[model samples]
Target: MRRGWICFTFFATLAAMTRFSIPSSAIAVNRSGSGGPVIVSIPHAGRIYPPEILAAARVGREQLERLEDSWCDLIAGQAADRGATVVQAVWARAVADCNRGEGQMAPGEVALPLRAQFSAPGRKERAGLGVIPTRLADCGSLWRFPIDRHGLNWRLESFHRPYHVALSRELARARARFGHAVLIDLHSMPAIPAGQPGHGARIVVGDRFGRTADDRITAAVVEEVERLGVSVTRNQPYAGGHIVSAHGRPDRSIHAVQIEIDRSLYLHPDRSPDHRAVVRMSEWFGGLIERLAGIAPGEDEVPLAAE
Candidate 1:
């Protein structure tokens, strides 16, 4: 019995290593140099999970699907066609969340020293939605067993680091070309349950309560979404995450704002996005990007009357 158990463990570990050995091209960048100052970042829309990660998953596929910002990449792609640079992650967030901060590992989760230094844990880390997530909302925990530091480091180096590097490079390029850059971190939120106070809101714009972006830019985004007949809120449940905090520098003319669309608007009853709804949302997003692009570098920092 002991010999059989040892053999099973060895084979499982071997399979994981073999699957993870291949280099992952997890980030896709599309730049058209159409002179647009906007860069759309879709970090959570990925659906691909590497075989090594899949082997460790404790949750069912459906539960993992819930973590994705479904069809968000498609919506961002529309903006990309209209001259906006798009940088998106292709690896599933369950494997390595690109939006999370680098140091957001759970207490004693992995025992390896990272090559690069990282900051202290953030709120998401406390909630189990860290850089390498341990749990999801409906599914308690995702990993069947504790992963070694080496495996964790591989995920960070292969998927998480590359995604951010591409995003940073795109932002720098946009800023250099246009004298300013507006990073629209696109995401989707789960449907608001019945009887929620802000249930009517279809869109949530987060600028970290005016810290990550200029109030004028935030106002412009809110107004645009409201014009499309979608109720909008600012900095309620989610007030932007690590992406916005790390990249946004209004003083330097680099602004980052997170936009969260209610999944109910585009997703059908089965959680798959309706093509027609996605088209409409994409159109709306395209217009929003155009409006943002028109804002001059200095104009965004000014306090608008609405604010």
Candidate 2:
């Protein structure tokens, strides 16, 4: 497997640069030139589970696999020569969900002493989808053992912290060189529920109700998806998550949005990538990146120095 990261995979004049880290290798950072203004974040595509994580699980591979975004990585796998940066985590989300914040742990998920670090568990955390997933719908209590302080720190340092740190750094670098930046936090979703607004939609774009990005970004996303002959919706049921909240700073010319692709559109029943669908989605993203790279933010959205 590709262990090292900080790479650049190009489209027109493509070149990939890699930097190596630890724990199932590191993230893949593919740049083009100065890495344009767009950064693509694949937080949940991780498939590699260390022996420790698998051994600690009460559920089998199928239930553990539920934590993955499946093959979401391939959607943006080849946005070459387009100057968009892609930061992809290779470790499985079951190891440590990258989209969740550090404080999302439940009181019972961690050892008693470390419980104070987290506030009251939110709906997601309580439901066993927190930073370190503790339960699933039918599979109650996911771990064979509780999360002690060493276990908690190991995950944070090895998985969660590294993913976010790399993402933040790349976003900052893109913004610095391009005068502004946008993060496309990518993920895959199960079919939307029957009554949901985006139930029949093939793609859903989220910007946390206009807080994480300019309206223009969302508009551009919707337009691009429609151009590919796919139905799209916005902020329906699934808005952006902790990744958007933590990195999006439109106030400073850095924008972020979450894009959820319905798995049925591109995955097999077993959650593997459908090659044809993957290629179509890849080309869709490639063209969209080119188009978006050309869209300038508002004049008032100046790049301010950090305070």
Candidate 3:
């Protein structure tokens, strides 16, 4: 998994201008919710890259684009017209990955003294991709200099934390209104070889090995995708990530699932998103959200309070 299971094959170096746009806000929240208990989360599709972050990168825009879900927000937003609240991160993942845990880090990327705070870095982190990405594919380490405690904390407070806070708040609201909430954490992935050995899956639905969502929730997702005539798989290559682990609470009647779509399905070779492909996927996803809204814990199931 490249950076918490965002599968990325070696990205051919590409040339794009420095992304140094700083909007007034870093995230977008639509708490009003479409019409149901569904909340759409577009965590990895952000493109905003402040000047400071651009200056720190050792790779080009193409490599950084691999970090993005690449317009995944559009698919979620287009499909969310049916009563789903959408929480989107406008800040690029190159700045701070919204899908990773706050403590997850690559030790070597942080200054030595600050590195002592973490006894172990996850495999992804050790590979130089973590909450604050330090490496990419063959490009090696991303930063020229190690991040200090101040820099690390600033990235979390400024970008990562707020996105999670907004997502959690919206989940709480959706649950309060409908007695249960469903979070569809949307992401995109490089294509997996079909009819081959390992993962022939194009649509991978992850519920953290069923720890984050109920069996019924995950089942519905698989069924819907299968209905679309696309190959889907369970938690093999990706069993969800921090977003699902942290926000998903089936015991609390809040279900979360991370869906990884094949970029080749909608992304053109030139790197632009195909409009028709996006619409078809959007229609399918919109229906999936609607279907999930009809599902909730049975009367025998007791929901715990959200902490």
lDDT of every model, 2 decimals: 0.77, 0.80, 0.77
Candidates 1 and 2, the one with greater lDDT: 2
User: Residue 287 CA error for candidate 1 (Å)?
Assistant: 0.5
TM-scores for candidates 1 onward, in order: 0.85, 0.87, 0.86
Model 2, residue 256: displacement in angstroms? 0.2
Ranking by lDDT: 2, 3, 1
> Model 2, which residues run further than 4 Å from truth?
1-24, 299-307
Q: How displaced is residue 126 in candidate 2, in Å? A: 0.9
Over 136-199, each residue of candidate 1 has an lDDT whose tens digit, in order, gives 7766877765545556766777778777777788888888877778899999997666676456
Runs in model 1 with CA error above 4 Å? 1-24, 108-123, 193-197, 300-307
Q: Which candidate should be chosen as best, given TM-score against the real structure? A: 2
Candidate 3, residue 102: Cα displacement in angstroms equals 1.3
Per-residue lDDT over 1-307 for candidate 2, one digit per residue giving the tens place of the 0 to 100 score: 2211111011111111212124547566777664578899998997888765766677897898888899898988776455688888888888788899988988888767888887689999888788988888888887766676656666677778888888889888878877788899999998888987778887899999999999988788889989989788899977899999999999998899999998977889988789999998898888778767777778432222220
Q: Give the Å shift of residue 32 in candidate 2.
A: 2.4
lDDT of 3 by residue, 74-102 (tens): 67755556667888888889889889887
| Candidate 3, superposed: residue stretches over 4 Å from native | 1-24, 32-34, 193-198, 299-307
